[model samples]
Target chain A: MSEFEALDFYLMDELLSDEQRLIRDTVRQFVTEKCLPIIEEHQAAGTFPTDLIGPVAELGMLGANLPEEYGCAGLESSTYGIMMQELERGDSGLRSFVSVQGALCMYPIFEFGSEEQRREWLPRMASGEVIGCFGLTEPDAGSDPGAMRTTAVKDGDDWIINGVKMWITNGTMAKIAIIWAQTDDGIRGFVVPTDLPGFQAIEVKGKYSLRASDTAELVLEDVCVPGDALLPKSGGLRSPLMCLNQARYGIAWGGIGAAQACFDEALRYAKARITFGKPVAQTQLVQELLTEIASEITKAQTLCWRLGELKDAGRARPEQISMAKRNNIEMARNTARRCREILGGNGILDEYQAFRHMVNLESVYTYEGTHQIHTLIVGNALTGLPAFG
Target chain B: MRIAVCMKAVVDSQARIELDGDGNLRQDQLRFEVNEYDLYAVEEAIRLAESDEGHVTVISAGTADAVQGLRKGLAMGAADAIHVDCDPDDLDASGVAAVLAAALHDGGYDLVLAGVESDDLGGSQVGVLLAEALGYASTTLVVGTNEPVDGAMQVRRELEGGEHANVQVQFPAVLTIQSGINEPRYPSLKGIMAAKRKDLAVKGLADLGFDGAPARRVESLGLTIPPPRELARMLEGGAEETAAELVRILREEEKAL
Candidate 1:
């Protein structure tokens, strides 16, 4: 197998520290040697490779950007972004597991939970001894989570949560779910243990995309927990939105990984696959496709790296993240499609990664705030007007 | 105990090596990595250090690029690194050994480890020469090492034709390691972070009390790709006829039945 060389047309490596480069190279090697070998089989069977959790955690990838006080790696944001890029290069499914565990689940607890809550969950989750999922989207509230009907009613010292969550990544496999519900004050976050009496997580079946990931629907029929389960600092929809921003930031970098994977596979196939009288790589049209994809990947990489720097500096804006999430995912989707075309009939085969990445990009394009939602966010930022009604 | 691992940076064997018009390697295009056998040596040093509460210091002789290999060794749990700032191409085996011996001479290390041979040169002379320079007893083709018993280290040496011998050497000895001693672990993230904080001392030939000139130099004569082997012949006929032809070739043409 040809090694996946990350496109660094902008010399982005010059901006990274030695530690960051080491982390990136280590994770890239891990993904190339470990994840890529079994990803296809898992995707074919539509099963998540649970055996990888230990190895992934051993790399300190779970909550890697978080502080080391709670057993995390405490790496810089750019290093975290590079790790996401490498993981997604192997498979979007693998990256999704990390994104859900780190950005959506662990991050919220670290950012908004009480000291006791943080002390209880962060270390175990970081070690992959316990898996977690974020539950915000509902059956009727896909794009507009404010319309979620999940309710948390006070029953003495306990809050009884009642509702259903949809399209939850890692829902079926998680040991805990960070559920967002409407309380008397506003929407609040609650940590609901999956083993609770009234909580149920059923695996969603027949997903054509992101086949190697575990997506599920969570049902809470009066799931009761002590008042301590509520994230004391979380109030209103902004809390979940903050978590989505973290995940979306990772998605921006991850989109480039998928694009790089497709581009690398297509480039290899073009040189080896012969048509007519010569290799297809010699054809002008094929070369144009390669050039365009390479150009877009470089641009996307620059955007993600700059955003990572801004994030590390605590100067990044959510709208800027929206722009990157929107632009990079679109670029990756388009690149995957073009790379698929470049591979011709062989593109549809599972042996080639372009088709698999092309399909996975569809889910990545839609999740963590859809492409349309992100476009509106950027549009609202650019023009001083609210476009969403 | 303190262990010193002598490492070398060599071009990746799988990389495409190109020769320039002057018959010199196109070094700019080739990807250089830590010598494969040398990695086993480094791993063994780290293992020995970890179990004995000792320290491992990796030393490499090359230009600034050789620091990459040293950093990799550090990331794999070495305590520290020393970069001998000299272009590897400017020295022969003895000259390289001289530089290494100089760096190791005053370090007060109990043991010195090196690969049996580097992947690029395949010259199995450096360890023996380094032993001669440092006045230390030496063993080559070492497959394993036992804990020190009675101030002496017991090492298993792989002999020719699948044979092995156990030899014991006193402290301050040089051992050249063969590959497959153990599976080298990838650098963990914590180890990588720790490596960033560890000291990487850069030393020059003058610091080692030697002039920049080498005692011996190696000059390449030429380079060529080995000739491809002949393709196998295919016999075409009925199964019985093909089988008969095969038997005839093995019995008559080969003079064996």
Candidate 2:
């Protein structure tokens, strides 16, 4: 593959600090040199690239935006978003792993866990000696996590969790799982060690979307954890929703990456592949598709940059994040389809990235609050009314 | 074993090459990175310093943009950095050598390392010239080095056509490193963060007491891209006819009969 030409139509690079640009470039190099080579093979084999975890951790990608005191990079929100963009440029599955690790798993611990929990886990997790997964979505609770059937019952200063979590990313290999369950008080998060008795993570197999990632059905049959394992500050569905906000912000940026990857593949193919004695890129129809994709990508980049700035300022609302996630993922989905169309017959092949991203964006479109869920969230914010039944 | 590594900032390999009407590079349009060869020199220095428990300092002579390259060195675990504040356009290779020598003269470095050549210029003269200016023993195309023993270090050099030579250079020496001496590591996030806190002292020519404008003993005669080569002709014939044609051309066109 040719080197990724960063699509900075608005010259967004000028807005980034030197450190932020360096971080983004470092991750970009890692993607080009490490991830792109093996990702297709892994996706074909339906296996995760486990070897990259060590390198990714050494780069401090996990929990990158957290505080340096707990062994993180302490980067700004925008830098973290940039990291996601570059990582997803390689593959959405790869970005999903980091998002699950940083935003879903490690973030809750830092935000709501006890200080001892943060001290014990964050450093090891930062170094990649330990891996983590988040378990919130269930067979029944896809969008409304408040309706989750998982229960955490009090038993002699230990919580006995009994339930199943579906679509858990990084589940099988995680050393620990951050499980959000319904308690007597409300929906709460628990830091459950995967090695504990009655805890099992069965790999969800034969997945077409996100094939390079490890998804699993995590079952907790009366799993017991100490009282300290509870995330002290977490309460109600809002806590888990906050975690989703973090991951969604990353996905908002990640959508652009997937779109850009497909766009790059299609552009290269259009310029090189000859039809009717002329390059397809020279044709008006092909040019139109390329232009539309580029324009959408530029708009998405602008949106994400402003969103990141707002997040760093602590002024970004959940509905605003919903707008970004919804708009960018839908934009990416449309771009991927058009790019795939531009590739014509070759679009179906895994050798080309268009179809691969086309399928992957489908999963991205649904997960982390589906397109419909976000639309309502934003709609509600605008109308001052609850439309979600 | 306090070591100093000399770095050079060159145009990034991926940046589009645009020459001015005068046949010089459009400097403002280019993005500069640490010279590829200099990474090997920096890596070797860091490795030696790590094993021998010494400090490594990186120094470079270029414009303000050169600090970005120096920061890369620091991120690769160099103990500190020294930036010789001067426009590279103002200096030839000799002037660069003089600036580096002036910076390192008072630092009392036990060894100095530099790349065999800059990626853009490919002059391969800076290290040797710096050695001469500082009155230190020097070796070029050094591929490997052993630990210092009895005030000298064993070094391996690559000669022409895969031949190798081993020599022992005394302390306070300069070694121009070749590529493949070692695989340079990506700067870890921890290293990148720590580099920000590392000491980076920028010195000017006046501060180094070389107050006069540098004399360019060898000046550049501009640069131009070589003309594109003609495409090769394809043979349009059966295997037997093509083979016969190739032999005929070899005998007649080349006069090789």
Candidate 3:
């Protein structure tokens, strides 16, 4: 693949600070040198690239937006968003790994876990020495996490957790699982060590989308953990939903990366591919497809930059995040499809990335509070009416 | 051990180069990075100075904006940096060497390292000129170096035609590093955060006891891109005719008979 020409139609690069651009370029180089070369083989084999964990950790990518006191990079939220943009520009699987590790796993521990817990796990997780998976979505609960049946009951000084978390990224590789389960008071989070006797992680096979990522089913049969395992600050379903908001923010920017990747590949291919005695790029229909993809990417990029700004100011609402997630992901899904069309038959081949990103965007569209769920969340915010009922 | 690595800030290799109407490089859109070859010198200096009581300082003479390049060296584990504030374009290779030599003369450095040549100008003169000014022995195209023993170091110099010569040099020697001498590491996040706190002292021409004008022994006339060559012509017709045509073209047009 050719080097990605950043499709910044709006010249958004000028708005970023020097440090932010430096971090973004660093990650872009890392993905190009380390990830892009081997991702296709891993994607074809349906295996995650485990070797990248060290390099990623060495870059302080895991929990990068968290505080430096906890061994994170302590970067601005916009920088974190840009990092996700560059990571997903290579592949969604690579972005998913960082998202789960940083936003979902490390965020909760920093926000809800006790200082002891944070002291115990955050540093190791930041170094990639200890991998973690967030267990919130259940087999029965997809859009509605409140409907989850997983429960953590008090037994003496310990808590016994029993439930099955489905479609958990980094599940099989995690040494600790941030399992959210129902308690007598409400839904609370437990930093459950995977080595507990009744806990088991089974790799979910046959996944066509996100093939380069690990998805597993985590089964807990009376998994017992000490009292310190429970995140005392966690109150209800709102706690896990907050972590989703963080991850969703990153995915909002990530959507732009995937779309840009497809656009770059498609545009390059169209310029070189000849049809009807001229390059396909000269055709009116091909130009229209390219225009549509570029326009959508620009809109999504501007939206993500604004969202990142709002998040850094701490004024961002969940509904605002919902809007970005819903809009950008849908835009990416459409962009990937159009880019794939422009590639013609070669799009299906592994040598090309459009089809791969197109398939991966399908999974992205469904996860992190599905496209429909975010639609209702935005709709409810606008109309002042509950539509989920 | 105290070591100094001479680094230069050049235009990023991947960025498009555009010249102005005055035949000078358009500076507005250019992004500057540490010169590619200097990264090897910086890496080697850092590796050799890993023990306690060992320090590596990166020094560069360029415009104030070159601080970004110096900061990169700091992020790569340099203890500190010295930036000679001036436009590099205003100085030729001799002038450039004078500025660096003035900055490093009394710094008590045991070893001074630099790249064999810069990417943009390819002068390949700064290292030797700097050594002459500082009154130190100099060698170029250094591929490998062993630890200092009894105040002298053994180094392998790349020779022409796949040969290398090992030589011994005393303390305070200058070595112009080759690119493949070592692989430069990307700045870790920890190193980057720590770089903000590291010392990067800026020196004016007067601070180095000069009257703000370096000795410009050479000047650039102009720069132009060479004309593009004609596209290759394919021979027509089958074996015998094309062979005869190739011979005729080579003998008559190309004058290679």
Candidate 4:
């Protein structure tokens, strides 16, 4: 029951008001029932649970932490983590779907969009009527997005955008993309309609990790955007990094959920499957592995709880997210391996699900910011040195 | 229409539980969670409210400790909640059922649902007894449901092993939901915040008009941990040898290959 382990550390329950527990439990239930069943199948099909959009919206998951009105769910940062943890408990790909759509895409528009623009798009996005995607990483410029070749030029009352984005989640199906491109004003975001005359998206196939997630390559050529489509207040590399920061925080909690699921599966398998005439649970090594994995999960939970508090309090900086992103995700990857060991041969199969989880952990390890990228971010924060070349 | 759901505050059943000295459950050492199976009931109630013209209320028959579990239900869109507020030592499922029945009567809910059993206890009797106490037709393991007419209702019940049976019963009937009836919705942040002030209905024994009545006796409950396995048993062998040993063990020793 590593997955179901009611985590209470450092009197965390007392720290959370009654409302926090309620929210966490509600998300927990939704993850267990809704996401867990169909997640594997969707991954196999290389498609998304499009039907889930309405349900997710109804649960107020989309733009959930945004303010009330405009049909927003109006939760706080930690509450968003609650959603991520539960969603990723089913599959990291599914959680990534929400994080990209909500945190990476809608958030920038909400933060920097013109009032008229907000009034137009926020409600529709909130209602799941129009799905959104963020375009930041490009084929040529990935970790260093400041070097992006994608460009937008000003024309009277509009911006002509031309570029390609790689590894875009929800790209193929999204009706909107909050794309970042170099303008004369430097890197700026535009809430471009994907159906624009020259915009194209095709699903990215052949991924061993996050297979359940729909990632696509976005090609925008001479895509014209009205003045209203641009996020006017945002400028500089800071714009997209801010979005990445939000997504990373959610990933911090989400990675732990995946680890917990694997730990739970392994722990159960070890106890029930007898080896050499006795239950494997009785073995010290098996117990040791289980113990280590669960402890890692608990530690990750405690770290995320603190991170959530820091984020909700508005004291969280990029390095705080980077530290957690680096540590928790690697912790998840390690825990998945340990759990995979516990299941032995059954671990390799999809139904038992440890191997897929292990595989998915690899994608999680690389996305948003790779482990090395987060490490450099933290290193730079500590020494006041920029490590990324 | 008004609906009520009975729930338990169980340690996440998937959580690893350890016992303390002198035979009491060391919940302090264990990871705490809302009972897993009960969540299906909470989700169903939420869906029902969303679909119909009804209000859903949740009630649990435990003390301050049970508050978290009730809040979890409330956050899943239950309109209100109540806690019987009793000690954890109270053992009788019937006693728990009695408190729930009292809450049901007081709340005036037209329909009630419960998970067929607590994941920890798997006691599939509480809903049945509560239904009897309230004088309503009760069914367990409902897998599907239909709209309730003014006074009558219909539900699809899951029978033994992949089979299903549908039945209609009158108002005030109790139907226990089976797992996977519907994917339970997570509590929206709005639901979570709203659940905060929704009245826990905390009451003492006198308020429910009962003082420790029992349907069954507790005859010593304890957990036993099997002896640890010896370290020498784990063999370090190559794949072929491992497979041969596994097959031999599975066939000759355990009598199943």
- Clash numbers, per candidate: 0, 0, 0, 3
lDDT of 2 by residue, B1-257 (tens): 89999999898877899999999998777887789899999999999999989999999998877887788889888999999999888888889999999999988898999999999889999999999999999999999999899889999999999788999999899999999999988877667777889999989899999876489988888989999898986888899999999899989998998
The full ranking of all candidates by TM-score, starting with the best, is: 2, 3, 1, 4
DockQ, candidate no. 1? 0.52
Docking class of 1: medium
How close to the true structure is residue A113 of candidate 4, measured as C-alpha lDDT?
90
Candidate with the larger lDDT of 2 and 4: 2
Q: What is candidate 4's CA lDDT for residue A33?
A: 69
Stretches of candidate 3 off by over 4 Å are: B18-29, B233-257
**Model 1 ranges off by over 4 Å:** B13-15, B160-164, B221-257
Write one digit per residue (lDDT tens) for candidate 4, span A12-87.
5666667766666667767776777787788788778877788788888888888777778787888788778877
Candidate 2 clashing pairs, residues 3+ apart or interchain: none
Q: Flag regions of model 2 displaced more than 4 Å.
A: B237-257
Clashes of 2: 0
Q: Kindly list the per-residue Cα lDDT of model 1 for residues A1-389, writing each as its tens digit.
A: 75777666777777877677777878888998899999999999999989999989988899888888888888778788888988999999999999999999999999999999999999999999999999999999988999999999999999999999999999998999999999999999999899999999999999999999999999999899999999999999999999999999998999999998898889888999899989999999999999999999999988998899899899999999999999999999999999999989989999989888989999999999999999899999999797975
Model 4, span B10-106: residue lDDT tens: 6665555777766656776655556666778888877777887689888887757678878878877788888888864564766777777876776
Candidate 1 local Cα displacement, residue B84, angstroms:
1.7
Task: DockQ winner between 3 and 4, please give it.
Answer: 3
lDDT of each: 0.90, 0.91, 0.91, 0.82
Candidate 2 lDDT over A1-389, as tens digits, reads 55887767788888976566667777888999999888889989999999999999988899988889989988788888998998899999999999999999999999998899999999888888889999999999998887899999999999999999999999999999999999999999999999999999999997889999999999999899999999999999999999999999999999999998888888888999999999999999999989888999999999999999999999999999999999999999999899889989888988888777888888999999999999999999999998996
